[model samples]
Target: MLKVYGRANSINVRKVLWMLDETGQSYSREDWGRGYRATGEPDFIKLSTFGVVPVIEDNGFVLRESHAIVRYLANKYGRTDLYPADLKARAVVESWMDWAQTDLYAAARPVFHAMIVNAADPATAVAPTDGVKSWAAQMLRLEQYLTGHGPFLAGDQFTVADIPAGLVVNRWFTLRFDKPSLPAITAYYDRLSERPAFRTHGRNGTP
Candidate 1:
């Protein structure tokens, strides 16, 4: 069985869980990070030196980093449709995955950290406002991408690319920031919200 170590509410962990659910793979989840940091304990640290929440123990392979874990799963367990077998199609999805980590996280982290962890009102946080503005602007880029395709980031077919973006959408909505008109992103979220995996992950608010 695959063992996942992370708190339920974590966006990173949520992405991994969502992907697993999408793949219809069963795994064990452990409470860790934020409310619990088992990753910091000597035993867990021996496995994941970074002490991150989303550590995956599959068979004997121990891996950390949420995005990497999901990508690994997509390649290993995902139907070729999700990860895709064609090089160009796979590249398209993988590009979004990398963009989510590099660009989306850069924009969303400050807003999420201030609003959720610092317990500061988003309206009052200068960094969060700036961060949200950046995030919303970045979302416009995604909106443009999605505008050409319905219901999915990569295209007509849903893929692993949607997983992290879905988690980011939850954070964006929760922050209560004034988002620029993004019909495509909104529609995408609406679709994702209907998924059982997203609903299951939504049960607990971020810690």
Candidate 2:
């Protein structure tokens, strides 16, 4: 069985957990940086110098980073559907994965911090900023892409792109704010919501 280190509340950890669920990979997970897992533990630092959530050990090969772990697991298990075997096809899917970490997540960060972290009352907090502008613009871009792609981000097939994307889309919809809606993105969210794995971890209702 694979071993994963992270807490369930972590978004990055959720990505890995969701992937494992979708791939039907069995894993033992340890709560890190919360509950019982002590902070600055030497054992964890040895596995991941960055001290980030979602470090995986498959057999004896240790790996970190949610995106890398997802790709590694999908490839190692010969799940070519999730992680495409073709170079170009894989690149297209991976690009969205990167975009989630960089562009989409970046766009959502400040607002997330303001709403969830800095606010006095998380339930009613809505921090106004241009972050929503950038986020909505990017969502519009996503709408255009989905219009062409019809269903998935990279192509017709649901790939690894959807794993990372699922969490972000969940956040977008769950985040309480006033913004123009993207029907395509909403439709995509509904499609992803149908998957049992996604329902279990991706949008388990935590932002």
For all predictions, the C-alpha RMSD in Å is: 2.4, 1.6
User: What global local distance difference test value does model 2 have?
Assistant: 0.85
Point to the candidate with the largest TM-score.
2
Using lDDT as the measure, the top candidate is 2
On a 0 to 100 scale, what is the lDDT of residue 17 in model 2? 90
TM-score each candidate.
Answer: 0.90, 0.93
Question: In model 1, how large is the Cα lDDT of residue 196?
Answer: 85
- What TM-score, to 2 decimals, does candidate 1 have? 0.90
Q: For candidate 2, write residues 73-120 as lDDT tens digits.
A: 898889998888899988888899999889888888888888886889
Residue ranges of candidate 2 with Cα displaced over 4 Å: 34-39
